[model samples]
Target: MAQEELKSINFMGWRKTIGAISILLLLVSIVSLAVNGLRLGLDFTGGTQIEVGFAEPANLGEIRTLLVEQGLENPTAVYFGSETEVLIRTQGAMQDGALVLIGNRLEALEPGAQIVRVERPAAGQAGLSQVIVLDGVSAAQVRDTDIFDRTYFGNVEFAQVEDGLAVTLENSLDVAYTNRLLTALSEHANTDVELRRSEFVGPQIGEELRDEGGLGMLVALFLVMLYIAFRFQYKFALGAVAALIHDVILVLGFFSLFQLDFDLTVLAAVLAVIGYSLNDTIVVFDRIRENFRLVRRGSPKEVVNFSLTQTLERTLITSLTTLLVLVMLFLFGGELINNFATALIVGVLVGTYSSIYVSANTLLALHIDREDLIPPPKEGEEQEELVP
Candidate 1:
C-alpha cells in the first residue's frame, strides 16, 4: 500500500471545533446520567431478577400491571432476553415468597405462560441439530420444546437447574438466605429449582469490584505506557496513555453521570475499549514515525496531520461499520443488551476521537521525533513495514 503523501491540515485551527464537540458530548453524557439514569444490571447493583415465560407474547405494560395486581408493587417488567419470557426484578427483596405466588398467578391468568423455551438441540456437534429444549429439558425432549423457539442461549437463567428456570434474586448477595428462599420457592411452586444464575454484589462486594476495576484500569494504562515507551518513545507512550485515559474517563463519566450500573461486564468493556483506542493510536503513531523518517522537512504537527488524513478513510470505514452494527443492537437487540450496546456505542465514539485528536495532539505537546519513535533500521529487520 502506498503511504499517503504528507498534507498539512490546519489542526490548531480546528481545536475550538473539536473542543466544542467534546464539551457537547460531555454535557449530553452528563444529562443521560442525570435524567435517563443508567439501567445498571444485576452484576452491579445487587438485586433479584425473575424470568417467567408466558405461552403468549409478553406485553410489558400488562406484565407490570399484572405484577401490581399480584401485589408486586413497582416490579420492573422487561422482556426477557429470549423466549416468550419476561424478567421482573425487585430490590432488597423482602418478597421472595410472593414472586412464586405471583408466578403461579400469572400462569393462571395466562394459562399459556409456560417456562420460556430456549434450548438448542445439538445436531451432530453434540447429539442432534438445533434440538431446542424447554428452559432445561433434555435433548430428547427438545422437539417437544422447539414447537415455538426463536433465539440463542435459550431462556435458561445462567447456571439455573432444569427442574425450573432460576431467577436472579440478588447479585453478590447473602447466598444462604437466598438459597433458602430458592428452596422454599422450589417446594412452594412444586418446581425443581437450581441456583442457575445469581449476581449479588453486597455493598462490600460492589465496592471491592469498583475499587479493583479502577485499579486494574490504572495498571493497564501504566503497563501500556511502559510497553510503548520501550517500543517507541516515552513521548509516544505518554500520548497513547493520555488518549487511553481520555477514553476511560469519558466512558466512566457517562456511566456515573447516568448512574448506570458499573458492573463487571461494563468494566470489561471499558478495558477493552482502552485497548481498542490504543490500537488505533498505535496505528496513527506508526504512520507518523514512518513519515518522519521518510520526510525530514515537516514538523511533528504536520506529520500528525498527514498521518491522520492518510488513515482518515480507513478509520471512518471501520468505525462506521462498527457503529452501524452497534446501532442495530441498541435499537432491536432488546433490553438485556441495552447497556452493553450502550457502553459500546459510547466507547466507540470516544475512542475514535481520542485516537486521532487526543493521542496525536498529546504527542505533539511532547516534541516526539522519528528516532525516539522508530529508531533507524536495525541489522536485519529492513525497517519493519509501518502499518498501511
Candidate 2:
C-alpha cells in the first residue's frame, strides 16, 4: 500500500552524469589539496602570542605597523575580544635580548651633581664589562647609572624626551617581549595598554598537535564504519563510509584551495561533518532497506530512486536549517572561530550532497537487493511447519 501511494523520481536516470561530475569534483579537490595545501595557524606553527587591551578602541593596522617596525617578523595583529582589544602574534628575535633600546640622555642636572660616564668592573666570575662612569659620586651611585651594564645587554634607561620620559628596555625572545612592545607603543600611540595574556607554543608541541589531529580523524572514521556495519549490511556500511570520506576530502579541498587556516577547531568541525553526513546517509539507507522488502517487484535502481524521492523533503529541510545556523556563525562569530565556522559551513553543504548522491550511487554500484538485507530462513524449518 505504501509503495503504491509513493511517487517515484528518476534519481538513477542521470546516474552516469552525476557520477562523472562527482568524480571530477573529487579529482579537482584532490589536486587542490596536493598543490595548495592548507594555511596552518599559530596553533600549528610555533610562535609567541600576546593579548592586550588599549585605553581606547585599537587600530589593528597601526599596531601591526608598530610591531613590524620594532623588528618583530611576520607579526599578525587582530582584534581579540572587542574593538578595544588586540592580539599580536609573531616570531621574535633569533637571539635572546638582541634588540636594545637606548633612551635620550638626561640634560638637566643638580647644581652639585654632574652628568658623567662611569666604569664599574664586571661583577662576579663572568668578568663581563659592567661599565659606569662618574666624576664625584661613589661606586654605588655610579652603579645606579649603569644602564647598559647587565649581561646579555639587558637594562632599562629613563631619560627626558620631547614628549615625556622615554623608556629604554631590552627585547626578550620569549612571549614576554613586553619591554620592547611597551616602549614602541608608548612612542607611537602614547596610549595606556594592559597585557591580558601572553603565551608561547613550542615547535615540538605544535608538531605533536598536528600528528594527533590526523590520528583523531582516522579513529573517528574507523569507529563510524564499525557502527554502521553492525547496524546494517556490509554493502550499506561501505557506501556510507565512502560517502563520509568523500565529504571530508571535498571539504578539506575547499580549505586547501582557499588557503583557509586549518587548526584544531577546524579539525573538530571535520569530525562533526563525518557524523552529520553519516546520519543523513543512514536515513536514506533505512528507507531503501524498507522499500526493498515492500516494493519487491522493481529493480534496485527503481527502489533506490523511490526511496530518495520519498525522503527528499526531509533532507532539504534538515540541510537548510543547519546551513542557516552555520551562516550566522560564520558571519558573527569573530576571528577566533571564523575558520571553524567556515569549515562547518562548507562541510555541511558537501555532506548533504554526498549523502544524497554519493552514498546512493555507491549502493547502486554494489547492486544492493532485497536478498542483501534479509537473512535466509532456517533450512527445512518452513517446510516442517507447513507439514505440521
Report the lDDT of model 1 for residue 306.
Answer: 80
Q: By TM-score, how accurate is candidate 2?
A: 0.78
lDDT at residue 190 of model 2 (Cα atoms)? 76
Expressed as tens digits, the lDDT of each residue in 1-388 for candidate 1 is 2234555566645755776676676677666657766555555555566655555454667556555544433456677665456666655342333434434544554454445532443344432222211243323333234222223223322233555433322221133234444454344445454443444335565567667877998899999999988877888888898788778777977887766656677778888788778888888888877888877767666777887888888788888998999899989988766777888889988999988878787777677766675556677565455535
What RMSD does each model have against the real structure? Answer: 15.4, 9.5
The positional error of residue 198 in candidate 2, measured at the CA in angstroms, is 0.8
TM-score of each: 0.63, 0.78
Residue 73 error, candidate 1, Å: 8.9
Off by over 4 Å in 2: 1-6, 71-74, 91-153, 156-171, 379-383
Instruction: List, residue by residue over 1-388, the lDDT tens digit for candidate 2.
Output: 4446656888888888988998998998999988888777777777678888788888778888877666665677878879888887775332222232211122222233333432334345142333322233333433455333334346534444333333333322232346546656755767888878878777778788989998988888888888878888888889998999899998898988888878789988999999899889999999999988888567888889889999889999999999999999888887778889998988888888888799999999998888998877899989999994
Off by over 4 Å in 1: 1-5, 16-40, 65-75, 95-201, 258-261, 374-388
Best by lDDT: 2
